[model samples]
Each structure stands twice: as structure tokens, then as C-alpha cells.
Target: MNALVWYVIMKWMPKGSSCVDFVTQRSLYEVRKRPSKSYSWVAFMLANICAELPWNTLMSVFIFFGWYYPIGLYHNAEPTGAVTERGALLFLLIWSFVMFTSTFTHMIIASVDVAENGGNIATLQFSLTILFCGVLVSPSKLPGFWIFMYRVSPFTYLVDAMLSVSLANALAFCSSVEVSVFDPPSGQTCGQYLSACTSIAGGSLSDVNATSQCEFCAIMDTNAFLSQVNSYYDHRWRNFGLMWAYVAFNVCAALFPYWFGRVPKSAKKN
Candidate 1:
């Protein structure tokens, strides 16, 4: 639930407000005029990108405090005595997420002739990321052909890292209703019957000596649950690094369309 909330918030946060409003508005007048007069498109793009950095950084700090503690994800690190380490990691990931959102919004908006068109494209792209980011649907459950989408989505790494940091190593105790009850074979104890399966799949067996009413908690720990969704605790930092690669990609990509298509050829000749 925390991961889902994070994903939804990050994905929709830029949608509710314009991240590149400053840049896009400049595109309407200042970007074209400056490029034609003395500035190169690259210069304009660089300035615009740099100009937004401080604000985005500030926003990330606000978002981290507002969302992280309220969601109670800090508890995940509490039991493991990794509160400081995990907290710092989560803050960095949230900061990266904010930077990605801003840069991605800038890229899409700059890549088009019309802001409306860019917005529509961005919406479509965001929707695809949401569908394939291993939240609404597990990557394991996605069909072979659509699996690439899961791999390509930036949200994939972001979500995986966030979930691992927030949920990994924690124990999951099933409520009475969540525990499964079944009978073991005629001569076997519950542990003897299900030991092989639990050894491989992970679960806790109750009443090891009983043949009837064998209880099991299918989700033993956060690690086991994360594995089922194709995420792992060990890969948390790796995924965080990967997510920044996407952010850098977005930052670079934001310059392309505006430079090639939006910039006037006459401006280049100047």
C-alpha cells in the first residue's frame, strides 16, 4: 500500500501542475527570440534546465517529509535497526523521483509543437508506466510480449527500490483469516508434509505434529513477498542508481525535440 501510494503520488503529481511551465512559456516567446538573436538552442535549454534545479530540489525535500513519515514506511527500517540508512536512502529515492518527474515533464512538453499535444502524449506514456510498473500487475504475471514495458518503465526501478527499502526484511504475520488450514497426509506431520514446499517457496507452518488443521502463513516475510513480485532487498540500491540513469536520460532528452523541431532553421543561421 505504501508503494502504491508513492507511485500514484509521483505519477500524478506533475499532472496536477505543470513542472515545465517556466520553460514552456519561454518556448512561446523568449526561447525563440533568444535563439534567433544570440543564444543557441543548447544554451537556452541548459539555462532552462539549470534554472529549475533548485526549485525541484526544494520540492523533493517537502515531498519527502510530507509523504514518507505520514505513510509510516519508516517502521520498516525500525525493526532492522537500519532507520538512518534506510531513511537516507528513501529520501534520495524520493528526490530522484521528483527530479525524474520534473525532467520527464520538461522533455515531453519541449518535444512537441503544442503543449496540449505534449500533455496528451505524456498522459498516455504515464498510463503505460502505471500499467507495467509491477504495481497494478506483477511483472511475473505480465505476458511475455508485454514484459518489455515492465522493464523499460522508469517507475519499475523506482517502485522496486521503494518497496524493497520500505518493506524488505520485515516480517508478515497473517491474521486468523489469512492463515490457510488444511490436512496433511495420513501418516505425515504438517511440517513433514509441507517442509519441502516451504523450503523452496517460503512459508511458516503451524502445528508441525498435527495431521489435521495444518495452518500456514504463505507470506513469511517482506523478502519472500517482494521476490514473488520480482523485487529483491539486495537490489534496492542498484535500482535506485538505475532510476537516476533514467532521470539523466530525461534531462538530456528534454533538449532534443526543441533543438531539432522547435528551433527555427533561420535562428540557427543567425
Candidate 2:
């Protein structure tokens, strides 16, 4: 599909120019021109951050109050309640950073694809994104080489951070019930100790005993549950820091392509 689109675009492109040349020239022109001194790149970045802040905060509040609050109440869980405020703040920060990084990273990728592959790299890019982002398999289960991809993907950090913020301290109560045979001690007084008590009094053990009580027990605690699923909060802050670092790295990466692609063909020959 991408090939067909590129073919059509190339076939009809302006007589003397290809898509790559056009994109490179346009991008270089934009970079070279001083649009406004008051509106610098730093100012643009700040504006993007500020613009995303309120939306991120609103989403965090909704998740905490609407989703977390009700679920905690339903389960009679109190651990999350204590840290809801802190967790929400962390969630907001991480989400905002991720949004910023993803936006510029995507821009960088698209720009590079246009300049190098005539934008035919979409399918490859999408596949790689999904593969490395833990969408197809969990990071812990990925093979050695693929594990590197998982580790490098920003999606992995986002997922880990979100899970840590939402479910780290949350408690889940799980119960199991079982029926067991009533066996008396070897020397105990059988008549004095009517050990078997059932709904049908004086009924035989083999008979239907609807009155027999089922034993219900708690299976595991919060830590056990988290460990079972390989979820942890110990590295949440670290992940957040890494995500922001990715944002910075992506911004630089996006700009690098523009610089690289802007070199004139004649200059390269000379």
C-alpha cells in the first residue's frame, strides 16, 4: 500500500523534483528562515508542554476519582486511597512527558522517512513500534535480542509507570472455598463428639449435605499478587526520568535529520 502511494506520488510529482528533494528543500528553508525572534524553539517547546499539562492533569484526576476510587471502594481497599494524590501527580507528569516525546519522535520518524524512503517506511515503522512496545509479548518473555527492543521502547516505560502508579499499593482480596471430609480422631468419644454437622442433621456422610459449611480463605497478599504478575513500583521514578530523557533525545534526533537532509547535492559532490 505504501509502495503504491509512493509510486503515484512520484509519478505525478513536479516535473524536475522528487518527493525527497521537495521535502528536504522545504524543511531546510523553514529551518534557515528566522520566523520570529520572540518565538524560538525553546519557547515552542514550553508552549507544547504548557498546552499538554492541563489535559494530562484532567485525565489523571478522572482516572483517580472515577476509576480508582470506585474500584477501591468496591473492594474495601484502603492502601490506594492513602497514595492517590501522589500517584495521580506522578501519572500526570509521566503522561505529559510521554505525550511530548511521542509527538516529536513521530515527527522525526516521518520526516526521515519522507527524506530517505519517500515515506514508504510506514509499515516497517508501525510493525517495529508494536513489536517493541510489548503489544505482542510481555517484556519479560521476549527473547534476548528482542528484549533489547523492549527495553529501548518508550512504550515499555509508559506501561510500567502507569501500572505502578495505578496498582502498586492497591490491595486485592481473593478467596477460595473447599469442602473436606470430616474425620474424627482415633480414640475420641464418637457419640459425645458429634463432629459432623450438616444441613441434614443425623444424615449419613454419603448423603447430600447442603448444610455443610464451605471453608473460605484468603489466598495471597498485595506483594504476592504484584510479584506473581511481575509488576513493581520500585523503578517508577527511574522510568519517568528515562521517559523525559527520551523526550530530549527525540527532539535532538528530529532536528538532526533536518540538518542532515538539508545539505545540497552539489555540496556533497564537491
Candidate with maximal lDDT? 1
Q: Residue-wise lDDT of candidate 2 within 1-270, one digit each (tens)?
A: 123222322332222123354455445444763243444444443443356447655654654465445544323224545465554545454454435433443344434535445334533443465467554577677888777787677656655655555555554444332223344445543332343543223222232322333222222235444454444677677777777777677666655564466433344664
Per-residue alpha-carbon lDDT of candidate 1 for residues 60-159, written as tens digits (9 for 90 to 100): 7887788778878888888889988998898898888877777777778775656566677777887787778888888778899999999899888888
- Model 1 spans > 4 angstroms off: 6-13, 16-24, 27-38, 184-189, 209-212, 266-270
Candidate with the greatest TM-score versus the true structure? 1
Off by over 4 Å in 2: 1-77, 105-110, 113-130, 133-136, 175-219, 263-270
Compared with the true structure, the alpha-carbon lDDT of candidate 1 equals 0.78
| Reference-based lDDT, residue 144, model 2 | 83
